[model samples]
Target: MAQATLESAAAPRESAPAPAEAKPRRSGKAATGLLTTVLALLLALFIIGPLVWLGVRAFADTWTYPHLWPDSWTTHWWQVVFGDKALGVAVQNSLFFAPLTVLVSAVICLPAAYAFARFEFPGRRFFLIGLFAANAFPKMGLFVSLAALFYALNLMNSILGILIVHVLGTIVFMTWIPSAAFAAVPRSLEEAARDAGASKLRVFFSVTLPMALPGILVAAIMSFLASFDEAQGTYLVGAPDYMTMPTQMYSLVLNYPTQVAAVFSILLAIPSVALLLAAHKHIIGGQLAEGFQIK
Candidate 1:
């Protein structure tokens, strides 16, 4: 009987059915998940609330504080946005300048970015740092200096002058993106193309450029939007003759109707939103850091 008792005592007690503490651990996890969800919802609301408000105000004929909803809705503001002659001209100028800036910036930045990615030489690091420095410096200072230079050259208020300023603004982003894209491309692929009797130019266009196209497209969109939304440079350089949507919107905000300004804001947001939505997959999938590994 003692042996039997000893055997019964020695046998495991079916692992004790896991302690009650396990329930608290699961509960803690559940609480953490709930908190995370709440925070995400709040963050999303914070970002989207103003945009929703702008849309509401754009349509509402009479919306003011203390009201949960607009008293009445109308398309009057949108009609004003489209029918206003000055706004039309401003939109046209912006359309012309922004795309032109992107084109010129791409032309200048592509080869420079490629060189930075593919070659190492004297002052390369210095040059790269210089690019970053140019970008980092306050736009006010740069535009102030450029204004003086443009005045001296009789380029002030000219499309060319504004284009030059926009190019300067966008070149940094353009170079950084394509450089990463080029660096990500395998050198072996280019070598193989060369070994197959392809010329350097042919290999680059066929192999390297195609691989980096997604990044290039993203860079182009950014450049376009940066130039499109430019206010300070356009104001300083293109004002009194050339006016962009942003500049016009700035004036309207201070002097014109709030509803009209809201309408302009919505119009200005459309192209950027459309482009991002269209290319979101490419933007998300493109690897910016992967190509930096030299091996």
Candidate 2:
């Protein structure tokens, strides 16, 4: 009888109903999830709306004051802009200058970045502060001086002039980015390679470079975009003959009052987006994502 009673008690406890506490908790979670989804939708609309509007306006045949939508939509603006020989030339020039700037900037800045990140250089802080300070100054501030220098050197209106200026302007930023990237690499990895009889150069090439590649790639992409999209200096230095897309856009705006300018703007953004996507893999590569630990 005692055994039977004990067995019955255990069975009832084991088969008991679930506590009511879990019911409210599940309901709270579902409500929170619904609120989060609504917030995300709102944020997406806020960001994507402007981009969609620009695309719509670019395609509009006749946009007017106080108009929410164009009276008619057409591809005439795109056809005209793309069909122009000058537009083709501008695209060519931008393509050449942008990649050249990225390459030159990377080459020139690599040594400086490595030194800053790895060595005990004198006045490093001062150099870094100066770099940030230089960025704060408007590009326009140097236009007059740069133009005068170019004229004196007989480099005005030359592609070389544009390329050199873009390289110099982008170097400061490229160096800083890679310096931070190189610094994020643990010194222990380099030491281990050395202990295994790897030379400094070898270790750098095999270990250090690969480890810091993502940041380097990001910096390169940024430099490319900056050079590609730069308007002010390119216009000042590359006027008349060396018309970049930006200079062409200016010419169009001055001569025409249509949405052709928006077409150019959209086309200009293509290279930037393409470059970003190309570098996206590197930006999220396993080595960078796991090893670098950069915030």
Candidate 3:
């Protein structure tokens, strides 16, 4: 028995089963990856192709259909846009109002954000949901309704009217985003600070505020962009005397050459693009999604 056991132990073990064939699985994954890349490229073209074409049109002197590329390039439209007085005023109004709306929104909504974050009050969910009421309805319909109200209040055609309209677009982002941020702060940190003899206010300012600041800042960026991009409401309520850059696009598209409009469009997109590029990391980091959690 011992000799037989030794022979068995010394003998070569039966070969272990070979790994299941992976080529089919690897090929399937490769095919899926290739398909995803193609789809992504196509989607990118669909979204970005027009922007590229616009850039081309802005410089193209006489390129038309059937041409794959611009025939000639010129700076005529650029010079014309730069010299236009009305366009200058529109540019000024956008730059002026967007930042102020962000500031006003922060003041009015930050406290509300804090409340929603820290307090458990009756109707909290209802109120949180209500934040979308401003933007939930069709924007044109909402603006039309505001038009009558503004007319009654003697706000029509004034800077104040435009600012108010811009502020309306900001409330959701200002409240929801910052509130999400505040809620995400770990209570333990605040408790630790409190146990160390720090007051509630002090703990909030030192710990809570610092941690949630990223969300607040992301909200601010979004608010600024929305206010800047708003057109329909601004046109309905603040037109004729107080045109913003976006509202000015109506006149550009209708009366000016396509190249001229394209140039102005590029100008209008610059700030939005710059701000988005700057805050992209925060946005991609998931704060915007966190803001939608009404609970």
Candidate 4:
């Protein structure tokens, strides 16, 4: 009877369930998921909150601090922005120059980028470093120097001159993108086209250019934004005669009410927003890293 009792006790102890290990794992997973959800919500709020506030304020008739909502809403601000002749002129100039800058930059940068990608020679690294250095240099300093140079050349207050400056500002980015894009393209494709009796230009246009179009488009969009948002260079070089949306916006901020400024801000953002929406897939999917990989 003693042996029987001892065996029964030992069997019960040995058969006892393993301390519910899965419960702790389940709790840990739940905690991690909750943490991830909280972080995502915070990030979304941080980015989207300002944009929502800006939209609300743009149409609000009267919004003051500590107020959860505006007293009323109206389209008066939109009317005011559109009705103003000077604002119209500024918009027109900005529209013209932004695209012009993109075109000029592409024309100049594409060939150079292709050259850098395809055939590297002496001073190639030096040139690339110089391009990067120029991009990294202070815009204010560059604008000041450019202003002086433009003034000396009698190029100030002209659209062409401003276009040139914008091109210079964005060319490095444009060039680098296409260079990386071209590098990512298989050389075998170009060689095959050439073997199939296609000229160098034909091969590039038919094979390489198409392959790199997404990257090029992304570069162009970036260049357009850079040129469009440029204030210091535009003000310094094209000011007093050539006024763009950015300069106009600055002036409005200095002289006009908040509603007017808000309207202008929304108007200024429209094109950029539209472009992003239209080509978002390409912009997001573009292999920027591959473009920089030379070998």
Candidate 5:
């Protein structure tokens, strides 16, 4: 009789349905996920919205202040930007200064990098500190001195003159950048090359250079951008008759309106962006990680 009574009680418990609490826990998790998704979408839109608006404005015909969207659309801005004589000259000047500066910086800085990385020299830390210190100074402070120097040298309005200034200004930073890169390379690899009867110069050219090429390329890209984007130095030293894109954009804004200024800004940004893209592969390579290994 007791066993029968226990069986009757257990039978009712086994067949009972699951509790309501489990359903709400699942719903809460789903709600949190949905909220996160919504936030991410909003953030993406906020960041990308301005670029899209700029593109739309660039392609539009009307650039009046009041309208958010264009009343009409045209390619006149593109045609004017592409076909102007002054603009063409500005582009050519930019093309000349940027690469020349990059080349000059490499020529001047590569030896410094190699020495700092491969050799133990007295006051090395002091030299690197001083180099970085130069980079940290406000570029504006050097303008008057540079302008005076250029005037004294008869280089005030010349393209090559402007290039010399760019290279000088860029050297400190480029040397530091490549020094870090070269320092990352294994000393053993270089020593091994030497043990195998390779001359130091040959080892540097064939082995060290190939290994450090990526960082060197990145530094060159940076040098090119710095030369390309320099405004105050170029303006103060070589003004009026010579117009870089920044100087031109400034003139347009003061004389015309925001729309024209925006067009020029967009055009000015293209070459820098193109250079970064070209150097992207090297800058993102694994050379850095490998170099840092103590072995």
Candidate 6:
């Protein structure tokens, strides 16, 4: 009788219906998931909507007010943007200056980054803070203040002047990003290589650089984009003769037909988009965040 009673009680406990709270818990989770998915889709729509509209306008011959779609579509605006000689010069200037600026920044800033990462030096903290301050200053105001110096040095309208301006803006990116990258590298690996009969230089080149490459690559991409897109300083220092694609947009917006401006806008965006896509892997792999961590 006792054994039978125990079994009967255990069976009742095992076969009891789930707690009344269980259904509501499950329903709540499902509701939360549905809300999250809806929010994600809305955010995506907000970002992509403008780009979709821009694409529409780029090929549209006539997209008047109140029209959801273009009345006519043609590729003629593309041809117009390509055939313009002045615009071609601006495009050339952008292409030529951007890479060259990256090179100059890499040469000057990489070693400084290495020093910042590896050594404890006087004023190091102050210098790092200074880099932030340089970037923090109001960009247009900074450029305006420097214009007087450019005039004094006859740097106005000169390639060297424009190059210097671009390099100035990129210094913080080149220094800060690579410094964080180098700091994150394992000193143990470098030391082990040194113990295995590798020279310090060899250890650095073979071990440190490879490990920190993603962060350095991210920095380079940022520097390249900064120099490529800089308009305020470039316009202030090198206007009229040295107008890059961004600066040229000002003229286009003012004087050119709307479609012409749209086509040029697309062309201007292409290189930046292509580069960001190329670096997308490194960026998404957390190197960008790693480099910006200030550690």
Top model number, TM-score: 3
- Candidate 2 lDDT score at position 203: 97
Give per-residue lDDT, candidate 6, residue 4: 42
Q: Give all candidates' CA lDDT scores.
A: 0.83, 0.79, 0.88, 0.83, 0.74, 0.87
lDDT (tens digit, per residue) of candidate 3 on 153-176:
999888888888899898999999
RMSD of 3: 9.9
TM-score for each candidate, following the candidate numbering: 0.89, 0.79, 0.91, 0.88, 0.78, 0.90
lDDT by residue (tens digit), candidate 1, 1-295: 4334433453344225655555555555556656766787899899998899888889998876799789999999899889989999998998898888999999999998898899998898888888878878899998988877898999898888989888988887788888888877899999999999999999999999999988888888878889988999989998869999999887999987889999999899998899888778767775433322332
Candidate 3, poorest ten consecutive residues by summed lDDT: 10-19
Model 5 gets an lDDT of 0.74
RMSD of each: 9.6, 9.9, 9.9, 10.3, 11.5, 8.9
Q: For candidate 5, write residues 56-97 as lDDT tens digits.
A: 766787657787888898777777777778877887888877
Clashing pairs in 1: 184-291
Write the residue-wise lDDT of candidate 4 on 1-295 in tens digits.
Answer: 5334544454445446644564555455556656766787899899998888877888999777789789889999999999999999999999999998899899889999988888969999888888888878898988877877887888888877888888988887788888888887999989999999999889988999999888898889889999889888888877779999999888999998888898899889999999888779876775555555434
Rank ordering of all candidates by TM-score, starting from the highest: 3, 6, 1, 4, 2, 5
Q: Which is the better candidate, 2 or 5, if ranked by TM-score? A: 2
Better of 3 and 6 by TM-score: 3
True lDDT of residue 111, candidate 2: 89
lDDT of 4: 0.83
Output the lDDT of residue 295, model 3.
Answer: 73
Candidate 6 per-residue lDDT over residues 44-124, each given as its tens digit = 889988888877788998777898999999999889999999999999999999999999999999999999999999999
Model 4, which residues run further than 4 Å from truth?
A: 1-22, 292-295
